[model samples]
Target: MTTLKKDSLLKGTLILALAALVARMLGMFQKIPLDYILDAEGQYAFLAANNIYLLLLVIATAGFPSAISKMVSERMETGRYEEAKRIYKASLVFGAVSGLLLSSLLYFLAPMYATDVVKKESITLAVQAIAPALILFPIIAMMRGYFQGRQMMSAGGISQIVEQFARVIIGLGLGILFLSLGYSDTVSAAAVTFGSVFGSIAAFAVMVYYARKLKKQDARLAVHSSAEARAALQPNLPYATNSSMKLKFRAIYSEILKMSIPALITSMTINLVYMFDTSFFISITEQVYTDERATEAFAALGTKAQSLAGIPPILAIALGSSIIPIVAAAFARKDQAEVNKQTSMVLKIVCLTGVPVALFLTASAYSVTGMLFASPTGYETVAMLCAGTILQITMMTSNSILYGMGKQKQTMVNTIIGLIGKIVFSTLCGYYFGVAGFIIGSTICFLIVTLLNLRLIKRDVTLHVMGKKWIPYLGAVVVSAAACWGAEYVMLNITEGIAEKLSYLLTVLVSGSILCAIYGILLLKLNIITAQDVEALPGKLRGPMRKVMRVLRAGQSG
Candidate 1:
């Protein structure tokens, strides 16, 4: 295959971020229907099973994909195409075997885990239903990493959309059908969980189709290589000769394990915190409240509050994933200037997006939570969680930078330290304060990790955060927060004629839009986003943004 131009950081981030936003929207829509279908107890069960599924899935695949991506990119940088191909092939085998084995373990152990460990026998079906998806996800992850390593995000992004779309459609359909048929809540939840399996299958199909097409393209290019060069760079020579492929596999696997184990641990840090909550939050609450109340509290915190809070960080996650390969390539070339530039750009974008989102969501937390979930019970928790989004975005971006800079072990250490803190804080606070305690604990944990990461970045790269550079973003946040709060207050006072739910919806929608406009204007007026920044926008947006910037600039000059 012809080597494509390396994707610029802005273009790559925008591509993945847009895809992530779409996927996140679909996910949010799915949750609305799910919350409607599953009562508090059922939602608790669903989240219980899902938390375990995610934790296991992260353990099985997270590290290898990242490791493969980094390794492949590093090799490709040196024009060692054959080595990169070998790494890809080896990772595919490893992913398939590990996925199958771990999936089997989960499927069989679901009963014990639900009944014995989590003390929730009702989640057995849900856990078992999601087990099959585990088998497909790792393989899919490997393919995504392959494309991401090549700095081609289209395949991965498209597959994510296809996956989430299929999951929502099939999962929701099955769930509704089961409920309509008068099935038990457990059975209905199980049916919904099966959606993950279908989604993974659909995603796998897309990735495979793309993989085969790319393989053929690469094969045609391979024919052009000279015979001597081909012989010297035989990636699959062991298969052709008397040498055992097992030995080659062993070597590749060892190298992958060395590189990936730390990443795996680092990746698991967030999920580990979730699992900690899943294990402790309800159990601790049960000591002070009835089982039913405990379950309701867990559902509110895990399902409603955490889910709503997660939306803002979708961009950060995408930005994090996209930067790994870009930064890695720059580091490979010893391009310190490019590394610093990319790092600074990513931080600015994260703060610009994340700060406003955190502020607006926190300001309008009750309305947003009520509008989305039909209840504002967890509004305070959601507000606190939303307040933590800035830290989450910063932590994710910094972690990715460290991972790309070949500091995976250091990142892992930082995550471990943070995870330990989370466990300690969550355990103590959850036992004492229930849902509010968990939110506070989580927010504090994120702060700890983000601060650690920032310190490390400064020490390693001599990266400086100038107050002048961030003042505009902070100003924008202040302005947006004030606007949203004012709009929300006005809507509350004037919308007495409207239905309560309708009023909440209107308050959020109207206030959110006004807040966005105000934020954008403040950003321009403060000169936070320059003409050059507008030029870097996607082709369709650039022209309009440029015109707006021109008018704004003219006004300033006049």
Candidate 2:
């Protein structure tokens, strides 16, 4: 990969990462108010509606973003800039129309899922309340796809921050207002969920603002292009008097769907598993526990634990989003070396940033949960689910690689296998082992998909992701987990007599440090992070990290 592309990937990843970080933190905070104000029953209604909407939203939007990104990036790379813009327009039109159709579907099906599945009609209102967001969000998603394709990530990042801020602020305030007015949990849920509509509006405004600016920039760049370059893009078609070439929009739409259907399946399958975890819980657990008890437990396991579990995978998602354009461009050029180089770097980067956070969350799950929630259930479940996200990251990264390479059918098949495995395991495990078993079952399937993808990648394009460092990499993960767990255990014993929130808060804050430090030491000692990896880091981070590396190596040598 060229230095410029590498730098673009890092910049894009960092921008998206920071956006995800803030959004996730706000999401976590949003949960706190939901927990305290709305209580367990309210949480169930909100999450049920929200989770169902997410599954459908994935169905609505997933097909377009990566497809558009891949198409746009490839076209832009070859300087077929007009073709790229047409792809965006095609996607935006399809997405807007589909978003509206699906929004209506969700609105109509609200009662079916709410009453039949969730056993609460109030959730129907909740489901319908946020449905309109789908109308505009799909368009926003296409805009993000276009920006990412152009390697202009800050637009998407800014939109995410703005969208999430709107959701959290409006969602929580409305919930509080409804509750204070003696409204039923039903009214509160719908009120809170309406925040999504506001968020969508905010995101739409932001994307539009960026889109206009990008158009101006592109127009400026296009003035310098020669007629020869424009003619080359479409050798069969005559260039216009202004050196512009026309594209067949129908063919472009066909190409997009061919790419997007599989892309949709591959990208949204993991989230399907996530949604299934919540959706299947009531029916499965109702057999073992009472309906009311099961509802409360769902809030604990499904809402609380799952929300916290979601934090670490943001890096994987951001990195995956950032890499698709780069990988797609390389694949288009038939640059196998660059593809492999990029594939290796993405996996390695996932390990560097994602692993330690997963381990820390796993080790300190109880402490973290204790600090956040008054409920005593789901403490161990949180740890297991958080650890499970490591597997989730592996699957996500590998799946994105296949998606970017346009291995559409293979990626689709492998991801569906994983999703089916999740459903089957979740049922059997939830039947026998109870609430936490759902996470375990889903995680086990993620591993199956991860291994399958590794095999496929090797068969197709031979990227030995960890290469010979598999042992040390595995060793680093194991050692970091052990150290964090041990330190948290010791901290727990020391802080046992204090308040639940304060004691666990202390344990989490302190033991989390041990996890990071131990992981850092292992990275230096085991050479798991190569010199090239350091050089690939963004400029602002690279200098500080080099200084740290030198100091650590000097101490080790002494």
Best by TM-score: 1
Off by over 4 Å in 2: 1-25, 56-62, 69-96, 142-157, 209-253, 329-338, 460-476, 527-558
lDDT of 1: 0.77
What TM-score fits each model?
Answer: 0.85, 0.84
- Steric overlap count per candidate: 0, 0
lDDT of 1 by residue, 70-156 (tens): 777786666566677777888788779878997899889988887776777788888899988989787888888787787666777
User: How does residue 370 of candidate 2 score in lDDT?
Assistant: 76
- For each candidate, the alpha-carbon lDDT, in order, equals 0.77, 0.77
Alpha-carbon deviation at 240 in model 2, angstroms: 4.8
For model 2, residues 1-558, the per-residue Cα lDDT tens digits are: 111111266687687668767765776567766776786778887887677555544553357666777788887666676687778888788778878897898889878877786566667788889888889877887888777777777887888889888987998789889999999886797888889889889988998987887565445434754767534432222223234667677888788778778878776775677678666687887677787887777788766777787888888888787787688889899998898889988988897898888888888888888778765467777888888889888888988888778777987888888878888888988887777768878898889889999888876575655678889978988888898888888988999898777888888888898888888888877877767778999899999888888888788799
